[model samples]
Structure formats: structure tokens, C-alpha cells
Target: MTTAYCFDLDGTLTRQELLPLIASSVGLEDEISVLTEATISGVLPFDKSFKLRVRLLRDAKLDWIHAALSEQVEFDRHILDFIASRPEQCFVVTGNLDIWVKPVLDRLGIQSFTSTARLDDGRLDGIAHILHKGDAVSSLRDRFERIIAVGDGMNDVPMFEAADWRIAFGGTHSPNRLLVKLSDFVINDGNALCRLLNML
Candidate 1:
């Protein structure tokens, strides 16, 4: 059936949010948290907030940022195993910068759709592109007959709208209220989420 699975990176696949972890490398975790909360609450738009946060942390050493993310982020084991079993059908669709989350993506060993980072001399210069999750889903239409999306936040609304099926996952926390409203299924446990994916 050429089914594709699209997963949100932060909080959905990984137990910790990547941006705050990256920000911590520069002692800006508190600042990043404010923007993250505002975005999640719909007070700040994802694009604007993402850019501001990126600007705030752009000067942090790339090696240190990568090391922190690799050390601090934890993935949901059940879901990680599920993707590992069928890596070809899975994609990480995230608004996070490609360079910042490289470690996580490498661990999953799956295709990914992420915001692009501008680089100058091996340093993070700025954001080159901000990915809209809906576009990521649309880009997959030609390749997959059916797409199933999993996420847990307000930022994921566009992705949910574009997918054939939406699952609001809360393995780390409660699924966002609006996201739950848009989802075909709401699951709070990692193992149960894998079971539902198998059934689908």
C-alpha cells in the first residue's frame, strides 16, 4: 500500500525537546523555554519564535551543542524500535534545524524533513529555511499512497491536516488539547502507540 509514517521529533519521538537542550549549551535554556511555551500555547507563531530562538543560540559552539543534544535527549524505546523495524517507511518531520538534530536523526537512520540552517565556516550562521510541516507531508504524496502522522503539539496542526491519518501521541506529556481534537487516535503510552501503528 506504500504507506508512510511521519513523526514529530521533539516530545513525540524524543522524550526531551531539542531546542531547549541546544539552548542550554549557551546558558539560554530559560530563554528558549519562554519561546517554546509561547509557541505551544499559540501565543507566538512557530516560525517567528523559531527564528528568534535560533538567533539567540547561533553563537554556541557546534560541537558542544551536538554533544549536549546527544547526551540529554532520550527517545521513547518502543517507538524507536518500531521505526527501526521499518526505517524505510518512516520519516522525521520536524521544524527543528537539520544541524542541531543531526545526532538524533543519525540514531534513527531514517529520512527527515527539517528546517535548514545557514552555515559559514562550519558554524551556525542563521536559519536558511523554516519548514512548514504540511509541506513536508505534501512533498511525500507522490511517493506514498497513504501517510500516517504522529505528533503532540499545536505546531503539529498543519501536519495533522495534511496526513491521511493523525495520531496525537503523549508518551512524554499530555497531547495538546487541540491536537487531540484533530487526531483519529490519542495515545499516551509508547508501547500502546506501537501497537496501534501495527494495527493500522
Candidate 2:
């Protein structure tokens, strides 16, 4: 079987969820976090929710977002090693902005699909779209015979459904119960994820 791997960035591949860091960088943490929670709870559509949250952080400095994300996010070492061993089969599929996730992706040497960061005058204009993660997986579908998806959020559920195998990670965030239920295999650590992938 051709095993194609797709991963969610925040709270799955990375140790921290980037949205809260971006929110905290601009002093909108409390307010924006509510929106985030609401989205996860399925109270609002992801695209509309993301746009609203991004607007709150629109004036944030690119440096602040980059620095905060770099400081807070760390790659799961086991996943890192596994990806290095089989570089061609893995890719990061995240809803987080690519600009904010640059450091981690570079270190791991992986291709990722994420929301675009729009810049008007060298400042973040806003998130270009939400539910961006689903689009990424759809694009990759035709190229792979068996797609394996992993994630921990409501936004991730759609992409997870498209995969031949799905994992719900609980190493970082408290994942939605629905995500865990849909997953074919559920794991909480990087080593465990690697083990499952190796067997498959």
C-alpha cells in the first residue's frame, strides 16, 4: 500500500497551538480564545471563525507572531526522526499560517499546506481563509493511494475522514471527543505515533 501521511500542526505536530500564541502576542488572548473554543465546539463555521479571530490579530507584528510561535512550538522528536527516515511519504497539513510555522517546518524538512498570510504594508492583514486544512488534504488525495491523517481538533475532523487511517493525538491539546471517536487509531505520544506508522 502507498501510505501518504498528513499531520495537523498545532497541538498535534507542534507542542503549542499557534492561534493562542498569536492571540496572546497582541493582547487579545482572552477574547480570541473564546472564539477559538466556540469554533472547536462547533458553534460557528471554521472559515468564519478563523477570519474573525484573525481580524483581532491583524495589526500584530510579523516578528511577534514569528518569535512567539518559535518560542512556544517544538516538533515531536520521534515524528521528526521518522519523517527524516522516510521523507517522501510525509507532509504537514495545518490550518495555522505558514509564515508562523516556518521554523518548525524548516527544521523537519517537510512540506506543509496552511492558510496564507496576507500582508498589505508589512503587517498581517488577516488570515486569508479558514477550513484551509480540508482543502490541503483534498489536493493531495489524487496523488496517494492510502492517505493517513492525524489531528486533534474539530477543524481536523473533515480531513481525518478523508484518510485511510486516522489518529487523534492528545499530547498537547484536549481534543474534541468527536475527533477521537472517528480516529482509526488514537495515540498521545510521538513514539506511539511512530510505532503505529511503522507497523502500517
Candidate 3:
């Protein structure tokens, strides 16, 4: 049977959140943190908050944003190794903009579903599309027989709902309470999470 593993990029695969790192490039980490917290806490919708954060960080140079993300964003080694072994079956599903997360995606060497960016003159103009994580899961149905999703945030609810199996991962921190409730499995260690994936 063909199984697809879908991992949320921030805090699941990566040790730190990408947007805050991108915000740091333009000295807007504090501002971004507010929106991020609100979004994760379910106070702000992911799409609206993501757009606001993107607009706030839009003025930062592309090179600086890339450098900040590349330097500060660290991946969970155990999870990274698992994906590297089966890159074809692993996918990073994130609400992050395409341009901002290219470095991370390139490193994983796997297919990704991310929000698209609108660029003008080699600069970030705005968001062209905001990805609905559930839609991403549905889109994979034609290809994979079974879909397993791993994530740690409120934003992952739709994805969890659409997936065949859900794992609430807290390798970096505790998975959101609601997300944990929806998951078939709750794993807090990267090694344990990968082991569960192998078992499934």
C-alpha cells in the first residue's frame, strides 16, 4: 500500500517557527510573535494573520529573510532523517509563503504544499494564494492510498480532519490541546514520532 506522510513545517519538522525568524530579519519579531500567538491560540484566523504578518515583513530584503531562515531555523534530526529516507512519500504542508520557505523545502528534497507568493520585480508583492491544509490532504487522495498527518498547532485541525491518520507531535513544544484531542496518536519526541510512522 502506498502511504503518504504529511508534516507541518513549523515546529513539527523544524525546531523553530519560520515566520518569526523571517520577522527578525526586519526587526519585527515582536510584532510577528503577537500575531503568531493569536493565530495559534485560535483568536486570529490563520489566513488573515498570515497575510498581516507577511505585509509587516514585506519590506525586509529577500536576501536578509533567506539568511535569517537558513541560519536560525533548525530541523529535527530524527524527522529529517526519516524524510530523507523516503523523500518521495514525505511532504511538507505549510501555510508559509513559497518564496520565504524555499530554503527549507529545498533542504528536505520533498514535495511541498505551501501558500504561493506574488512577486514583482524579484520582490515579494503579496500572497497569490493561501493554502487550505485540508485541501492539500484531499488533493493527495488520488495518489496515496493512506495519508498520515503530523502537526502541532491549531491551524492543523483541518488537515487532521481530512487525513486518514493524525499524529499530534510536540517535538519542539506541546501540541495544541485541541489538535491533541483530534489526533489518533500524541507523540512528544522526534524519535518516537518517526518510530510510529514506521510502524504505521
Q: Which pairs of residues collide in model 1?
A: none
TM-score list, all predictions: 0.97, 0.90, 0.98
Clashes per candidate (backbone, < 3 Å)? 0, 0, 0
At residue 1, give the lDDT of candidate 3: 97
The TM-score measured for candidate 2 stands at 0.90
- Model 1, residue 130: C-alpha shift (Å): 0.3
Sort order, lDDT high to low: 1, 3, 2
Lowest-sum lDDT 10-residue window in model 1:
36-45
TM-score of 1: 0.97
lDDT of 2 by residue, 87-166 (tens): 88888887767676687678768777877887777667776655466667778767888888988889898898777788
What does the lDDT come to for candidate 3? 0.92
Stretches of candidate 3 off by over 4 Å are none
Please estimate how well model 2 matches the true structure, expressed as its whole-model Cα lDDT. 0.80
